[model samples]
Target: MRKLLASVFVVAMMIGCPAAHAVQPDEVMEDAAKEARARDLSRELRCMVCQNQSIDDSDAPLARDLRLLVRERIAGGDSDSQVIDFLVARYGEFVLLKPRFTLHTLLLWLLPPLALIGGGLALWFYSRRRSKAGSATDPSHLTEEEEVRLERLLAAETSDKQA
Candidate 1:
């Protein structure tokens, strides 16, 4: 029942908010299938100008050029891989929204998990050390002279309060 309600809410949100695609009418291909392919490819290619936004979602001039270039490649009967390869050749791996897993990209993929594990280990060690060290000012570790002084201070305060 909870899953059903959550699914309904998700459906409602999707219906209520349509995606804001930036594909200009003039850039759309005459062939519906080619247009769909181009759109899909555009979504997978990042806009170099926007850095983080896909070409399909960016209004930048460079993004529009990339969209057109994608349509041209698709129209020329280039396979998706061929088109991606062409772009990667022209613009380096930064052109793809999701980069391929290769030795060159190993650090990009491994850094996040490595940082997380490193942070967790560091925190665990810190907490363990703190626990073992105990509190610097813990009264239980006081010497005989210190304990005698503490008792004397407490008795003096008690007597002053009563008076």
Candidate 2:
């Protein structure tokens, strides 16, 4: 029984360890240096169909095509930067997993911090307003007429109890 359980565990591990790599054997370049460059480029390129995944990790047909294109560019003697630029020009900045820092992307980077500071300011002002409103209505700060009315009500209750 123990051996059967051990066998099942080993099989499960082996099956789980082979994560789906979209690169087929045929897609790999003959030159080791070019293959390495292609792989690196693949990791930087976004899988357009699977927006969140890199081309290297995506199983989408478009991702496979992108992977092949990277290898083709590498084989054609394009520098890594050149290959990236080529793809960016063809597909726009969205094809890059990490877009270049530019004027257009400045807002993308700044908006989160700006939003956080704005939210904090709003919260601070809201809390201040709430505290001021609470203090203004406090029983200790009631008008003379309100205080006299409360005292009479209390006195009437006490006299009724005594009677």
Candidate 3:
């Protein structure tokens, strides 16, 4: 019974061991050149589901379908620009990682600089207001009564310390 249990444990451990990964035998490439072109195009296309990753690097089902569609288009002899246009037509400009510059996208491109200029103007206006309001005190600006009182207080403090 002990030997049988040990064999069973050994067999289970062997079954659980990691094995080398291999692509499935059923998958076949209709055209290797098209596959390469698709891969290159997919590298430039962002995965909408995973914004930071390109479609080529994403494992999401949508990314896989997009990759396959790109391959099919390339195999159909579509130029790079034509493939991109088709995708844009189907999925909007948001599908692109770097959207093209246009009147519609002008605000998206200009907002950062516009915000910076506005912020700089605000800071300048605020600083100008602060300076004009005389917030910084000068020694000459002290009133005669205040100077006298300060001198008397200092004298009293010094005498007390000496005592």
Candidate 4:
């Protein structure tokens, strides 16, 4: 039983491990530090073909090309930002997994909070109006005619009870 459990656990781990990076062996940089930097930048870049997956995770041809480009730029001694700027210039800002909060993307950042505040204000106003409508039947709010009719009803009830 123990052997079976051990075997099952091993299989589960093998299956659960993330798919190997799509980077080919030949594309690996000679410098380990540069290679690590390239890998990090690749994770930040969106694969043009995969759309949703980062270049590091994507198996698509375009993702592989982008990975190579990043390594080449790193090997050429470009700073991380320079490599990123090169890609952005070539592919536009959509290539970034996380967009910069610039003027163009300002509305994207602000929209959720604005929507939440607007919804809360609407709910507050609606509840306030609803409570006001509900409280219209309160005795203190009754018209003079309504108050007189209520008094008459009470008097009639008392007289009937006495008799």
Q: TM-score of each candidate?
A: 0.71, 0.68, 0.62, 0.69
Candidate 3 weakest lDDT stretch, 10 residues: 19-28
Candidates, ranked, TM-score: 1, 4, 2, 3
Instruction: Give the poorly placed runs of model 3, Cα more than 4 Å off.
Output: 1-40, 132-136
Q: TM-score for model 3?
A: 0.62
lDDT of 3 by residue, 8-34 (tens): 999888766432111112222466776
At residue 39, candidate 1 shows an lDDT of 88
Output the number of the TM-score-best candidate: 1
lDDT of 4 at 27: 86
Model 1 over residues 60-153: C-alpha lDDT tens digits? 9999999999999998999999999999999999999999999999999999999999999999999988976886568898999999999999
lDDT tens readout by residue for model 2, 1-163: 9999999999888766422657888999888988888888898999999888899988889999999998888888889999999999999999999888899999988898999999999999999999999999899998999999999999999999999
Looking at model 2, residue 68 earns an lDDT score of: 94
Better of 1 and 2 by TM-score: 1
The better-scoring model by TM-score among 3 and 4 is 4
Candidate 4 ranges beyond 4 A from true positions: 1-19, 137-163
